[model samples]
Target: MTGPSPETASRPACWRPARADDLPAISAVLTDPAFFDVLGAVTPEALAEACAPDGARRLLAFDIDGSLAAFAYLSGCDGDRPKLEEFAVLTRGRGTGTRALSALLEVLRAEGRASFWLHVVPDNSRALALYRRLGFGREEVLPDFWQTRNGDRVDLLRLHYDFVPAGV
Candidate 1:
């Protein structure tokens, strides 16, 4: 799907690798109320660890204003594909998630990754729709996949996408 265009309505966010100096901004974005509601509790240390690219890690997203927009991290899976462990954006209704996702696909393409997969709470309709728009398809749904911060268990929907180069 085509990404948000650079227009007056909303400037598309800039994409880059996570920097050591961006830890504070990234932490705030990840631990925001919106994030907590969807992703449950997130610790600062965990965010820092993910930001540090030791292996097949993530590339962080920053907005045009230089604010931390989102992050996408992956780890080795059973085969050549990588499992998208975490992907979250700070703001909504501005296509920040779309921008971040497009950037992620580019990075994966650069690395020649065959596929990327992730799991999300089934009830997160916004995220589900976004993933669908980005070419991800539901592989399975696991019951009682995780517990929320409020101690409520929830189901998880696993999604996968096989990347195909243009003109292939």
Candidate 2:
């Protein structure tokens, strides 16, 4: 709901709503072969349009040094179930992805969202492990869920994280 607390001040990265100007950087992250292979092709123009305030909600994680490290895009926020359209960390093994995801969840919980879900290519074992570690449960697998730029159809695993209201 609000910015990071004092305790998180020392954290290496912080998450904030992505702005129009961040589209290029976000596109760069999305264009990474590692991310593209898992997700799909995304041009700067397309990313800019998708992340527009009127479209999807985009969050970016910037390092203490003000460098863009990761980003997450959420679609269908107006509905009860928001879907994580894309999530990627430019710098791997630095906990950027985990931190970004944690921040997003905190914001979602504060907003009283019931649940959130994401579709990950089944072959993205690293991402799947991280999602599981973050308490996301594998729901189902959709065959040929995504067709890549190369025309390869990939199966995707749907994962979800349900929020339990406090004092329940």
Candidate 3:
């Protein structure tokens, strides 16, 4: 049930490469009840695999002190800009979300990734807002894109984010 302290001010922060050892701590934040309510349950083993050394994808973030205040996952990039598959924050009403997204964008930009794509559960209003604020837009809505816990499929909103500067 441990969570990040409330954010009192909005400030700039940077991100760095994440290691396999960070997986357990990162998984703890991701598996929190508050987060599970939206993304559903995910196993730590899955996270570890995603963060494995040989994986083409990567997970990165900015931690406040020793706590993972924010986190994100980039995948499917290969030779292109990787898509941000997931982003999360441990606190609400704070700028942690924005900072995290910004950091992730910077990393993608540095890697020459001009654009990426992802999908969101249409019902997650908060996540929708966050993605929009981070410059993601709805590209399409896939009906029955994701199966739910109750054996019912729900729609998903496909979103795209372009980080390339104008005329680039």
**Candidate 1's C-alpha lDDT?**
0.71
Candidate 2 lDDT score relative to the true structure = 0.74
**Per-candidate TM-score against the hidden true structure:** 0.76, 0.79, 0.75
> lDDT per residue, candidate 3, 1-168, as tens digits?
865445623333656556676777677776665554356444666566566433666667577655567667767757565666667776767888877777677767787776877878878898888889888874798987787554567888889887765487
Cα TM-score of candidate 1: 0.76
Of candidate 3, the 10-residue stretch with the lowest lDDT total is 3-12
Candidate 2, 11-73: lDDT as tens digits: 565666666777777777666665656766655666665555445545444554455677777
Off by over 4 Å in 2: 1-12, 50-65, 165-168
Ranking by lDDT: 2, 1, 3
What's the residue-level lDDT of 64 in candidate 3?
A: 62
Give the worst 10-residue stretch by lDDT in candidate 1. Answer: 52-61
TM-score preference between candidates 2 and 3, better one = 2
Q: Order the candidates by TM-score, highest first.
A: 2, 1, 3
The C-alpha lDDT values of all candidates are 0.71, 0.74, 0.69
**Top TM-score prediction, candidate number:** 2
- Candidates 1 and 3 compared by lDDT, better number: 1
Pairs that clash in candidate 3: none
